[model samples]
Target: MQSIAVSMNLLEFAEPVLIWLALFFFVKSGRVKRFPMMTTYLAVRAASSVILELILNLQRFASVSDTLQNSIYFYTYWAFYISAAISIFFVIREVFLHVSEPVPGIQRFGMLAFNWVAVISGIIAISAALPLKGLGAGMVSIGFQVMRCVSILELCLLAFLALFIHSLGRSFRSLAFGIALGFGLQAGMELITSLIAARSSYLDSSMNIVLQVAITIVLGGWIVYFLSPEPHAEREAITLPVSSPLIRWNEIANALGHSTPHVVVGQSSATFLQDVEKVVDKILTKNSISVNS
Candidate 1:
């Protein structure tokens, strides 16, 4: 236990350092401008680690069953946890955009699919939390579980993109690898930590140590990926003529309740619909001219 304490202290101290460095590079590399959600994620990590460290110190010294300490713990934990969760959700979407940037159609479709994934995952998380409501650490458990699933999804998304487009360019792969490293480990560690703690009601310092180490590795990886020379992607020109069938299929997909323009918070249905309309009109007009000729 003495060794455990020393290690945990070391990791806890290191977390903020790594986070600050990660934040620095995130902005320095102009990633903050390109991927605002990821920038927010790094900022949250730095802030949350600092806040959580303070909270832990207070809780350890305070007498058990102290109401004020408990209240502070709950409120602060939930605040950071929720913020991190939301930021990660958007980060995943943004990373997908980066990977699929060359393919506009795929980008649009991926965005649509990601909306459904977010909605379903959120509903599942809320339902899971329902039973654990009122438990002191229930919200944290819920947040971790939801994040674990999302992180796994992120890994799969990256894997699929890599597999399908073996040459998505160097810059794209670099970003994708950085994201996968962070979230892939996150998903695995959170699955173990969240499940074990929720079942036993015991929060182990060892888990905290592991979490910090994983995060440090991820932050360091980000720094390295950013510093390396960005490989230029050879993008193929895509100019497939859209047909009436393609438009009908899109309309059918929308009608089948597969669309979430309204359900996806912050997504503008008006702009999305307008974009779709323009594309469809252009396609139909081109087809009409070709047929007439």
Candidate 2:
């Protein structure tokens, strides 16, 4: 028990440090502008971890009352939780946009689809949380449901990238793929831990530790990916096959919400009218000659 507590404390301390390191590398790699939401997410996570740690320490050593401490912690934790949850959607979107950057049409269409998915997921989460008792409990439930939805979306995004990697002409080693991979791993761990916790209350403590370890691994991986130099080949343009489904879908998506080209009779209107009148007069004269014959 002492060992487990010590390990958990160490993990808690290491997490924020690792997060800060990863954030530093992310900016150093010059990806901050490209993935602003992801940068924001990392900042939020790091700040929340530090604040929550301070709250925990205050509860142990400070003169604060239990009620006051609980209130502070509750509001602080929930506020950050909500912020992180919201930022994650945008983070996922950043990854998607980066992956589809080669195809503007697909990027636009995917963003629209992603927006609809987000709306539907929120509706479902709210519906699921409606049955819970009390406002506080319901809000917590909604957060969990919303995160679960995001997890599923992350997994789907990872799968889409994997399955269409060739079609999209993207390398697996690209930064975009790295971000998706990390999120997918984190999401998968959350889902598995959630299932395990649901199945047995006794494993909840173990699962928490496991989840933290998984997160630590993912953050470390992200740090390495951001710090390492990318391959020169990755920068070269890729040519997609004509028969690729990605190309076909991109074409179809491009065709959507666009009007057919129309000829505009602007300054040439008078000349066009004169030519049309001459052709009509000639046709009328030919018809009149035929009728007389």
Candidate 3:
């Protein structure tokens, strides 16, 4: 038990360091403009970690009442958690846009679909939480469900990149792909850990440590990706063949939500009536000639 506590403490200390390092690389890579949401996520997470750690230290040493400390910690932790979750949604969106950048039409259409998915996921999450007992419990349940939904989305995004990488002419080594890969791995670990924790309380402490380790590894991977020299050639605009399915779909998506232009009459009302009379006279003449024949 002592060893496990020590390990947990070490990880808690290590996580903020790893996160700060990752943030430094992320900014150094100059991807802050490209992935602002991801930047926000990292910043929020790092700040939250520091604040939470400070609170813990205070609880250990400060003369504050236990109830007051617990309340402050509870509210602060959940607030940060909720903020992180919201930031993650935007991070996923930014990555998706980057992946689909070469195809504007698909990116536009995909965003619409993405919005619908988010709405549906929120609805489902809220519905799942409705059965919980207290308001606080329900809110917490909603947060968990929302995170689970986002995790599933992360996995889906990774799968999409994996399956369509060749068709999209994107290399697996690209930063966008790396981001997806890291998040996908973390998401998978989170989902699995949650499931196991639900099944057995005995493993909760061990699983918490494992989850922390996985998160650190993900942060490390992000740092490596930012530090690595990306191939400039891959940055060139990809030209998909006109016959390619992606292109075809892009065209179809572009065509959606657009209506053909309505015809307009440039002629004055008198001219329009004259032309109508002329057409009517011609048709009548043709009928009279046929009758005579």
State each candidate's clash count. 0, 0, 0
Task: Score candidate 2 by lDDT.
Answer: 0.86
| Model 1 segments more than 4 A misplaced | 54-66, 131-138, 171-173, 192-208, 232-293
RMSD of 3: 5.9
Candidate lDDT (C-alpha), each: 0.70, 0.86, 0.86
lDDT of candidate 3 at residue 157, scale 0 to 100: 91
Ranking of predictions according to TM-score: 3, 2, 1
Candidate 1 per-residue C-alpha lDDT over 176-286 given as tens digits, one digit per residue, 9 for 90 to 100: 666755776666776687677676765666667777677667777777876665554423332333543434444454456455566656856578779999999999999
Clashing pairs in 1: none
Ten contiguous residues with the weakest lDDT in model 1 = 232-241
Q: Give the number of the best model, judged by TM-score.
A: 3
Q: Runs in model 3 with CA error above 4 Å?
A: 59-62, 124-135, 260-293
Q: Is candidate 1 or candidate 3 better by TM-score?
A: 3
TM-score of each: 0.67, 0.80, 0.81
Local accuracy of candidate 3 as per-residue lDDT tens digits, 39-87: 9999999999889888877856879987887777787887788788878
